[model samples]
Target: MDKNILGNNVITQIGILVHDIEKTSQAYADFFGIDKPDWSMTDTADIAQTEYRKQPTQARVKLAFFDMGSLQLELIEPDHNPSTWREYLNEHGEGPHHIAFVINGMKGKVAMMERNQMPLLQKGEYTGGRYAYMDTFNDLKIILELLEND
Candidate 1:
């Protein structure tokens, strides 16, 4: 396996699962003295075509982004549906969820992740891109989110 498969370890974002998006966004902004970012809901089931644990699902979440130079901090608040975010929040509570890397080819990267013992847990389509959550917690202590822009 190539050690540079993830492309130089450039992490574009750090995702955190939260119970309340408004509250958490306020807390982060207030604590850091930065402006609170507006949160937005993800795409609907029809557009997203989300899959969780190998099954078609309608799971969605609200997302807020805090830009800090090159690294973005993403806050996620999931609805009461079946999803990787819900599973993590339920099992681990509000905390760090995943670290994301923007890659070129998602299919190849996913295969590499799987070959490295990190199987895919969930995936979904966004407006201009798609994302996959790799089950790397056992090895890396956090899920790996691979974003592929189209």
Candidate 2:
């Protein structure tokens, strides 16, 4: 097992891959009885390609972030073309995609993973966080993340 002490800013976020962002966003909003979280958009294919992961054959995605108490829930849907999430939905439907664990000392952690031959599947900086993805059990299904303190 891997062992590392996460910094105080560490936050845990869950990612839900969905077919409809609005529907999923509403569900969470209604459940929480709070205003829907904000939205974010990006074309992550470039980064995926660099990591040798499946290239997203989509234009972009409409992603919404929902705050649930302390954790943030991310809902993703392809706004154009198709994506890995879309494919996952086509095959399995909406469900949990991954869990993001925010942390500090990211570079140090990443280096350790590398020295142990468990280099991240993908790594990059975004939204005040340095993010890295590592698959659970060598399976590409679940992504384990290390997010920098933000």
Candidate 3:
């Protein structure tokens, strides 16, 4: 594993795909003895552009974040449509979807992953950052998300 390819080995988030964001978030909060989590829906415009399985598409998701000191716990609820989260939930049910790492050199790292035979599954932009999800489920049994924030 080239260190420069993926930047540092610091995981910033653990994302889970769920059927219901509110319910799942409440469950997590209850189990962890924390307050109810607030869910935020992704803005349509903020996505800018999106691609799934190399095809242009639309994926709406409601998200909730829980801070756990170093890493964040992210819950994702997919709209009743075709999306990565929906596909994951339909195929594997509710569970861990991906592990995200904050990378400074996002574009370079994405290129390196491509060179290493990891296909990009999806890519999108948010308010102050962008993210790319790589297909590593077969090899690592988990998707890898590379995020770059401004």
Candidate 4:
């Protein structure tokens, strides 16, 4: 079977790290003149500690999502302990953390990456979608994904 390669699909969403979810959401709302999208918080302690290789210890995140016309934007903030987002913010201020794509097979994709020595940042199912993260670059950066419902 041909292993599905990364970037073989469209980027459905991009997660931007921010310190303030509401304020950041507002900025996007005003900038795009669109209403704020739904928001939620996740513990992520276990997922972060286990899955994310470059993640800071005890990683916690407060995230919000915004629908931008044809795409979606996710705003994330690292709390509890510092995270890749915090580090990125410290180095370059608020900006893109990871670009998420919709994939055909998430587990298979992740397994392929694993066999290739690329570690997964996280792997689990949420809201009926399979998600995973992997860091291939040196900057502790990674790609996020959403698997098509099987």
Number of the top-ranking candidate, with lDDT as the measure: 1
Q: State the lDDT of candidate 2 residue by residue for 1-150, as single tens digits.
A: 445534443458887888777777888888888897767776465543323133324345678987777898888775535444454557677788667777668878766766665655655545555667654535435766777757
Best by TM-score: 1
- Candidate 1, poorest ten consecutive residues by summed lDDT: 1-10
Number of colliding residue pairs in each model:
0, 0, 0, 2
Comparing 1 and 3 on TM-score, the stronger one = 1
For candidate 3, give the lDDT of residue 65.
97
Q: Which stretches of candidate 3 lie over 4 Å from their true place?
A: 1-4, 45-47
lDDT of 3 at 116: 78
Q: Model 1, 24: alpha-carbon shift in Å?
A: 0.7
Q: Which ranges in model 2 have alpha carbons more than 4 Å from their true place?
A: 5-11, 43-60, 79-91, 114-119, 137-141
- Full candidate order by TM-score, most accurate first: 1, 3, 4, 2
Per-residue accuracy of model 3 over 64-134 as CA lDDT, tens digit each: 99999999999999886566777888999999999999988777888888887787888888889999999
TM-score of 4: 0.72
Model 2 vs truth, CA RMSD: 4.2
Worst 10 residues of 2 by lDDT: 49-58
Whole-model lDDT, model 2: 0.64
Better of 2 and 3 by TM-score: 3
lDDT of each: 0.94, 0.64, 0.85, 0.67
lDDT of 1: 0.94
Query: What TM-score, over all chains together, does every model reach?
Result: 0.96, 0.68, 0.92, 0.72
